[model samples]
Target chain A: MYDYSSRPSRLPLPVDERMASADIDLGQRKSIYRSLQELRQFEKRAHDLFLQNLVKGTTHLSLGMEAVAAGFGAAMRPDDYTFATYRGHAHALARGMEMGPAMAELLGRSNGVLGGKGGSMHLTDVSRGMMGSYAIIGAHLCIANGAAWSAQMRGSGQVTVCFFGDGTTNIGAFHEALNMAKVWQLPVVFVCENNLYMEYTPIDLITAVPHPAADRAASYGLESVIVDGNDPDAVYLAAGKAIGRAREGGGPALIEATTYRTGGHSRADPAKYRPLEEVEAWAQRDPIPMYHARLLGLGVAEGELSSIERDVAADVDAATEFAKAGEEPTGEALLTEVYADGSSRWRN
Target chain B: MAELTYREAVAAGIAQEMRRDPSLVMLGEDVAAAGGVFKTTVGLLDEFGPDRVRDTPISEQAILGAAMGASMTGVPVIAEIMFSDFLAVCWDMIANEIAKSRYMTDGQVSFPLVIRTANGGAARFGAQHSQSVENWAMMIPGLKVVAPSTPADTVALMAAAVRDPDPVIFFEHKSLFATKGEVPEVEVVGRLGEASIVREGSDATVAALALMVPRALEAADRLQQEEGISVEVIDVRSLVPLDTKTLLASVEKTSRLFTVEENPRLCGWGAELISIVGEEAFWNLDGPLVRITTPHIPLPAAASLEDLAIPSVDRIYETVKSSLR
Candidate 1:
């Protein structure tokens, strides 16, 4: 009975109105706010390091897209699995990974989370269940399905949450994973951070449908849910429903979060392609300022919010110093971990 | 000892490992109720049931991706890609994500999984279905490659590949599926990177793999009878963790080396072996190391063309007889 053509618009309600009606307790609210603050500080420091040529390779920053990661990270369980894309610093920090190791990894230091082998695009820490930050687009969705299938087979009751860009919706693996996940009723939640652009081009120009991910949900027998990516409360509520359903064996769900990246796609991109008016409009809706104002309006003291911001800044500064003091990887590091035996030797 | 076909040994090998390891699972298209397109996995669904033995859709990416994901997160898996050539459909997952994941993750995750596929030609399936592409996997650093010739080696190697705590690409030859050989009716586990000396001779070392092993043995028999050439035929089973010690010892004893390969002439597995022998056993060689391989071209579907395309018994005989002269 679901109508594909005449589907009603599901853009999230006004942020202040949703915050007033949100059922989240004060402690949870403070945690979400803190995560958002951490994400902002970490990314800004990364950008600064890149400018100073301390970070190597390329980095994809999730500047204005923190709510989607923060909201889901707060809602997910400690044992649950998280699969993220290259723009995954936010997701990694949100999952409670230490910022020092993550920053060291970006700097290609020996004390990195992956010992400087993975760099920025391939950050992985299995201990905290931040499975991996895959560089290849559309590949991790299918991998997420595998993790979910394992959970289902083991009767672990664990849910896997996979995050990707809106650009990934058009790729082959995305469709393949979606169809297979639905067919098997795997316990996974696919979140598409639709920033309205795929790299330099607007996604609407290349894609056939208006809502790339949510529109294709019905084809795979999934319910379409679009959330406000800038509002933590809205994202948290939508994520809770989807995660809860998946945990209770209700199959998989697809959530398309509409948001914008305040900066370019990567460090090299100047972002001159975006119009000035569009950029200004999106900057006005930045998640941090919106969440900060909402917290003050909800009878939380302004002093408390400022203190949280100060603490996050200090943490980012300490992490930067730690990364700077770390040594560069050398010698045996180049020829290790190619196989399970901890050596790269192919023959005797 | 019992005689079993190569395909039956595949099923027995998988069933044996699945019986021992409760965490192992299998997934692929037509792998469950259909018993696989090539029928290499018959009777598995009945023994293991639906949960363990799964029939997946025709999505190669999903099959490999799911297998990698599950293996990294605790459960070991054995996924089928139907045909070895179909690996191209999901090469990104196999080559990029699955192969390099452990190395890139700095050993944080391990993929203890097996990707078994029906490989090579002799049945006129054309170029799309028939390719001895073990070299493609050998070039990748993180994968372990295994291709067995006889029924016993199939079961033993399958056991090794399944138990190993790394990603292994198990290539089961389509041409050898119906061939039967003596298989011991007991628990048999073989080590990776070990070659079997199926024949012994003092004149020259002829290294072959998969279907070419049988052809090389037949050619060696013909050479000894008519041409008076004594050829040592070594089945170079595992390609990645290559058994170089056995190969080097054979080359040193024989003082001459020749490789029989079914892949294209350019950059085949034989090329790597020849390069190694040329480097390490340079003084041990009596003549130039020669590789008898199929020419670099798409395999034709016709019987005559296919026979000529793959290295045959006659081709192997003539190449060795003429090279030694």
Candidate 2:
């Protein structure tokens, strides 16, 4: 229902004027655009699968918050670690997780990303440096510090990027992690995607500060950085700066990207709490179409953008079929991986 | 062999592991320069330097969460949580994150970390500080729970926990910190899930862990000398990866089983053991299985109340003596 060809007229500046100052090259720009498309298509397929009753349990999607994950994922090295929250399908895909395994994971198949043990909330592909997608709020922030500490101890020079929702800023572990990260000078970057709503309620109703993560940055001795989450180039620039500083031992940085989730928090909720005017206003700033128009305005060919979309659609379709074809996890899988010895046996 | 107190052996055990593995790191509140609140981790900072042996703020979640994250990335970490009771504050990190990370990830990323805490009652730190919560860790499926009674076992188990590939919760009894035992001069690593039959007998079998081990030993000696009741005592060291072979064999030989526990009565570690024995060794039992445990109540700071709550040597002796008679 939204217009993809025309740019939003409400913007203060044109797409070229806003993105012209970004330092990213043409190749990186194309890659970020491609990542955005892939994320959007992948999440759409997941939602469709959920409606079809194939994805058991529940899933938290990053439908409109693709730029945050794609931007940070683009800036990160292949070997760098990524810790994200439950709404991590975007982050997982951005880190180069194969769509087949990712979709299979959501479907609870044997060949799923975590072999179906982790289900939808915990999509982990450590091989791709996607360490984990944590379901519990604020827990992975502390865990991210540990990964950064490991890199510091080993002199690996690898930065750890941790992503969470705006809701996490108010949690106790969030403050603890931020304080510890700063005190230790860990090489980590904390990214907060402020999607206006924290599940059913607006973040401002529960949060004390105007900017949840950025306002609290000074409390942890971090610089307050706010970026436009709907703008891929802006997110890329902010993510690159933070990740670069952390990699060079400048310590951790917190970037609060203001975005909006177009869908409900999960498949269960209808998101009826959101006002109609607010939802319509955010739909105009949708990251996918906004970036799509921006790329076209920046001397990109319409055929090239169309080709990328076609490729992403094919990939998503193949991935869906692959997930549908995967075998159910065997009963023996239930008892395995509880310990290092590959068995859950506690007694001899 | 050298005589070392339980507290001293904690440092020695950790220092030994840190020496062997350069990737091994330790962090906790007051654990580095301050040498731990219980003085269990003295000289770690001086030897390992500030980089590896670092002190963290009093954040239990951060301490354990950082340990979990580091271990996932190939660095084995030893985190001290100060007190076993404080684990409740960071229970989400330990229970949901660290314990389930490996299993949830289907073994793609494993957490090779050790969470060593000063556990059990006796210092009269009150209910908040004093608690034998190994049973709390025991109920979790992925954690390996261990409590050592002697200095030698402390050092040995610490070494084993550091070298292990899974997350281990090492509970050191506060009362036994001053208890001295003979530890080998050479590096010694003990296996997990193995119970030590400190004293062997055929009349009755008594199982105890941590601070209860020495008390059970003394009770067994007293029962032999005064009441002429031959009693076998087993140090049921590791709760998870439980040494059921030794325990069931002991029960078969003695035909009577008694558990001396410091945990509260409800859902204590002894309850699990009794259930396992009751199901597996029911025909071998000559009498009903008895458990001497703390009453289902919070520990009080008053010395008299505390003493009456925890099972004493006289209580173990009397319980076993009357049960046998």
Candidate 3:
């Protein structure tokens, strides 16, 4: 079992830990690392907005999961459909869903994505090809499968990236989706953010084989890779390559990211199921600090980094006020949106 | 008038439409080589070939999801769900996604997917297989739910479902398929969301849909002889784009309205019809609207229990009596 807490925790995220320690071309890696820092700062604001959106609803912030989104999101195009699970605010922010609207959506304001109907779990901005996030365990897999199949049929180079937690693999739709994606050579990247434990059940107990969960892909004759989820550059490089391969009709790939959720799955969860020593170990491997240290070693200025952090904090604070000030949707808006033309037979 | 079974008419209607519209495709579990579980897609695979006739894995969500995606383009896709009971699996994709897509997209995006599935109970297919989910589909606006009772009605309605520019759920009764009636072919295009007056009468109007149409017709005949009460039967082919004009006009003339449906009385088609009439033509109604339907219970698995779940001609006649009283 991988210990989550023994690892170091801080900003810039550690690219030195585990498999992410492998170096990339200095120039290219630096550019990705720089963009990642910017995205991190942007997401900090998103996290605050996410909290405000959850009017009693639970919001899972991607404080550690930012690397996976920032990295992969940088590599993908706006046309690409990004489907995600509940812990999706980071993914949404990376996909360009504004921090304010995203927060408004979370707060149940009508100005939010989905007009406040979806809250955090069902956030969708199809205009951005952010297909939508599903709250159901493993349900978005089917939606992505269908979306990818559609893209293949249309000859659209756009691929779909389906993000889910480690627990989603246990659901039947996971394998079914992969098999369908394989059979049709659909453009879809199945990203498994193996944040150690799925909610509270440790990966070892529920996962049967273990982390990476990449081994399961071979049964479908697809290549599977395990990446350092905490390392934004690593996640971005892997996602970029996999998404490119999928766009070229290279079929689907299962990329399992080995990382840890610093917090419990949802707001209310204490995560008592996780062993304290293990949590401390994974925390030591916190992606932010390790990456920030790497940037320092690379000679990036400490002053510039501090400035970026301040900017991010200001952005988040502004978004918080924006979301809070947004008006709630009237009760009329509820049934009004049920249909476009208001032609419900009952309404007649 | 040519005699045709509801199944034969449905198959003929789909075949004629496919022949007319080359872009139309039909795919489902057991719908290809197996000719559908009820043979509704019989000879369709041979006629349309592999491209048009496809057999999908038994994934309900996959089937509906694919159809929704395919319909985004000009390709008209008809997805058959073997049984309406299986709709529980993909209800989200259907209710939330498909039904809300067109309106949410500001009508720029139109999904012309027709989901064909066998619904209602007659065989001892148990709780898992037997369900009259027409009322369930009727709840959505962007999506239209069509039910064709007799062979003629089936032919007219299936073509209409295929031609509709919006998503349509075509529910075919497994029990009614073997029943035959006269059918006509008029260049394969039929008016969707239109009500058909199966039997015209003066005393009372019995508005029914799907399998309930025949039950209403039989009950009307029985009551005509036994109690000297004339019964008018109107088969409501489409549930969502309801032909309210025709339905209200029938009740306006007949004065009395009684609805018969296979679904349970609470929140079913019967309730919807009663509510619609109550809102539109409440004062025009000669008597209070009555609904004859199955009892609210998990469909019975046993033969007797299964038989007792849906409304029959006997129950329809009883409701007619109550409405007259």
The TM-scores of all predictions, comma-separated, are 0.98, 0.97, 0.86
**TM-score of candidate 3 to 2 decimals:** 0.86
Per residue, candidate 3 scores C-alpha lDDT tens digits across A1-348 of 654433433222334444444455555555555555555565455555446544647777666666787777777887888888778877777787777777777777877766676777766667777766667676677768767766765677888898998888887778767776677677889899888677766665666675535978887788869988887767877988899889888988889987787677877776766667666767777767777777676677878666656666677677667777889878765564333344344322
**Residue B171, model 1, lDDT:** 96
lDDT of 1 at A144: 98
DockQ, candidate 2, comes to 0.86
Q: Give per-residue lDDT, candidate 2, residue A258.
A: 88
User: On a 0 to 100 scale, what is the lDDT of residue A172 in model 2?
Assistant: 93
Off by over 4 Å in 2: A1-16
Residue-level lDDT of model 2, residues A1-348, one tens digit each, is 432213322221223355755667988988999999999999999998988999989989999889999998899999999999999899999999999999999999998988999988998888899999999999999999999999998999999999999999999999999999999999999999999778877787788998999999999888889888888999999988899999999999999998888889998878877666667777888888888777787889999999999999999999999999999999999999999999999999
- Residue pairs with colliding backbones in model 1 are none
Best-first order by DockQ: 1, 2, 3
lDDT by residue for model 1 (A1-348), tens? 432223222233346575656888878988999999999999999999998999988999999999999999999999899999999999999999999999999999999999999999988888888999999999999999999999999999999999999999999999999999999999999999999879877787789999999999999999988998889998999999999999999999999999889888998887767666677777888999988888887889999999999999999999999999999999879999999999998998
RMSD of each: 3.7, 3.4, 4.4
- Best model per lDDT: 1
